[model samples]
Target: MTELHRIAIDTMSGDNGLSAAIPAALLFLKEYNDTALILVGDESKILDELRKHNQEPNERIKVQHASEVVLMNESPALALRGKKDSSMRVAINLVKDESADAAVSAGNTGALMATGRFVLRTLKGIDRPAICAPIPAASGHTYVLDLGANIDSTSEHLYQFAIMGSELATAIDGVEKPRVGLLNIGSEDMKGNEQVKAAHKQLQDGGFNYIGFVEGNDIFHGEVDVIVCDGFVGNVALKTSEGLAKMLSQEIKAGYTKSIFTKIAALVSYPVLKSFRQRFDHRRYNGASFLGLKGIVIKSHGGADDVAFANAIGIARKAVIEKVPDKIEEQLQKHLVD
Candidate 1:
């Protein structure tokens, strides 16, 4: 029998609250038989939502009532102070207390980050945790880090991102060495700012599969497995890619339905178009791992629907099964000693 993994879900944080979260948890349960969930939110609402789907909380699906919620627009500092029993905070506490192997939240990103860091704390020698997610590239998916956690980071921080990212790719993507790169403007070693250059040197000698500087375009080429940058750059790249995907999907739909002839073409090519669309569907890649934390925390999109939130739960399960944090700490310890 497969070992069971427990995940804590913040059911009150997303835009649709229990409506979205309960269904997602059900969907996850239907698929992963070796996993259980702890839903954290208002008990009454969660129970009502579960009954809507003809479901009851079994031993595999338990509820932990949380008294409050951190609003999407609330400041992280303010939320941290006032929302002691918030669903997000309680979910992280489950992970911290070892009741759950991992936690997932579709809440205020800033508040989630702050609460996760505070509750789980960073792994030994890790200054700050980074937000990392997989992006669709030309050949396959590339895992990129520091999506929006630490806007400003030093060379050492970037190095830590590389180490964590490499371990993630190795464990999740099944890559042997995991080609890691430093995101830069140009390919040359001297083509970036001071921090990028310093990180470049650090990665070059860090002993992993470091493939020097990679341009923004290289991100989609799929040649690199892991790309490291400060939160500012990584977040901009991530948001820009999301915007482009949305715009392109919209334009394709609009263009295909413009006229009768185009409509016929669209019908004839529906399979190919759908395949292409699925390749870049953002929902399929909704979760971002909070790397470097002592425990696993997955940040889902605030507006994620049932499918997207289910994807977040899937990420949390994978991280727990792979022992991602322990692997990262092992690598970081080796680097620290050298």
Candidate 2:
């Protein structure tokens, strides 16, 4: 029998709120036989939503009530102290107490990270928890870390990010020796600032496969499995990539519909275009893992739809099943002892 994995979801959070999360939970339950869900939110509203779908809390599904809701623009400190009963916090509390294997939230990123760190705390030897998410690449995808969790990271922090990211790739992608790269301005050894240079030196002697310095363009090359950088740089790179993808998509659509001849050409190339779109769909990569925490917490995009939110739940399930946090702690211990 498959061991059951329970995930706590912040149903009252995100842009679409229950409309997206409830449907996503239903979809996820239908797909994953061995996993259960605990929808965290106002009980009455949750029950109403389930009733709308002709469903109720069953053996595989449960409800946990949270009276408060965190606003999107709310400050992290305010959300942490002022809203202890918020859906986001309650869901994370379930994970902290081991009542659920993981927590999934499409809430404010800052509040989610802050609450996660304060509640679950960081694993030993990790100074800060970093946001790690998958980015579309040429082959499969590359996991990039410190996406928006820390604006300024020291050399040791970058080294820790590499270790956590490498282990994440190993667990999720089944890559034995995932190639790790330090994101730099250029590929040359003399290119980056002192922090990156120091990180490169530390990673060189680190146990895993260190691929030296990688430039920004190398992210989509699919050669490096993990790219390490400070949160500020990583967040900028992520947003830029998202913007570029959007622009390219719009441009392609515009070019394809300009004339009758192009319209016919679009018809001919429909299959290929669809395949490309599916390959790089941002919705498919919606979940971001908060690494270095003692437990698993996945942050979905605030405006994620049902499909995107379901994908985030799937990520949480994967992390739970793979024991990602435990593996990360073990890796850190090994590195520290060495």
Candidate 3:
């Protein structure tokens, strides 16, 4: 039998409260009885929210009370210290203390990233663990690294991220021999800045399935399963992609609402379009593993709704089952010196 893995979650800081996230969690809990969950936040409110769903806090539905909730606008460090008992902090400590196998947070991303890095610490041989976000693409998903985790990185770091990202795509995206791509300005061998040029050489030398430099235009073509870049560039690429997806979606909706005829057509096509849009929604792709952490720490989208937050919980559970952290350690252990 699979041992039940405990997951600690920040209950109060998502776009919606326990009302939505809890129900979705309850769905996961019902399906995966071999899992234990810890909801860290306002005790009374969480209990009440659970009660609304005809459930109550119990042995499996554990609670770790936090005296305060970290507001998104608060400084990451200041809030972490000043609000010592915030939900995010409590959730992190659960993992730090080994009370839980992993902690999933859809709170202030900056706080989650900062606190997780500090509290859980990095594993040996890791320079810095980057955020690996799922890039919604034409063919399933591709794992992109350093999605704003580190602003800068050395060629060695990008090489490490490429390895990690490739591994992740194999596990999560189910792509074997994930074709790795270094994000660059053009397809030519000599077309990028020093970082890309350097990373490309290292990736080739490192024995990864390097697909050469992929331009921004190729991200969504399902061309590669893993995309890597320094955090400075990767973050901008991710945000720009997200913004474009949103704008295109908005324009489609606006066009549908422009006329009664269009509205009628939209109404008739609601199910298909909704399903299509769901394919590209950020909410579905919210959970990004903080690769190189000792334990599983999934940094969710800060503005995630209940679906996204709940999806993060599922991602955390899956990470534990797959022993992703252990896998990362195994791979990196070779690089660690005496």
Give the per-residue lDDT of model 1 (tens digit) for 230-276: 99999999999989888988999999999999999999999999998
lDDT of each: 0.93, 0.94, 0.81
- Residue-level lDDT tens digits of model 3 in 120-214: 88877788989998887788777888888897688778888987887777767567788999988888887887777898887887666888888
> Which has the better TM-score: candidate 1, or candidate 3?
1
- lDDT string, candidate 2, 158-260, tens digits: 9999989998898887999999999999888889899999999899999779999998998999999999999999999999998988899999999999999
Q: What are the runs in model 1 whose C-alpha is more than 4 Å off? A: 1-3
Record all residue pairs in model 2 with backbone atoms less than 3 Å apart, i.e. clashing.
none
lDDT of 1 at 86: 99
Superior candidate under lDDT, 1 versus 3? 1
lDDT of 3 at 169: 74
What is the Cα-based lDDT of residue 19 in candidate 1? 80
Report the number of clashing residue pairs per model: 0, 0, 0
Identify the leading candidate in terms of lDDT: 2
Query: Relative to the unseen true structure, what is the C-alpha lDDT of residue 3 in candidate 3, on a scale of 0 to 100?
Result: 66
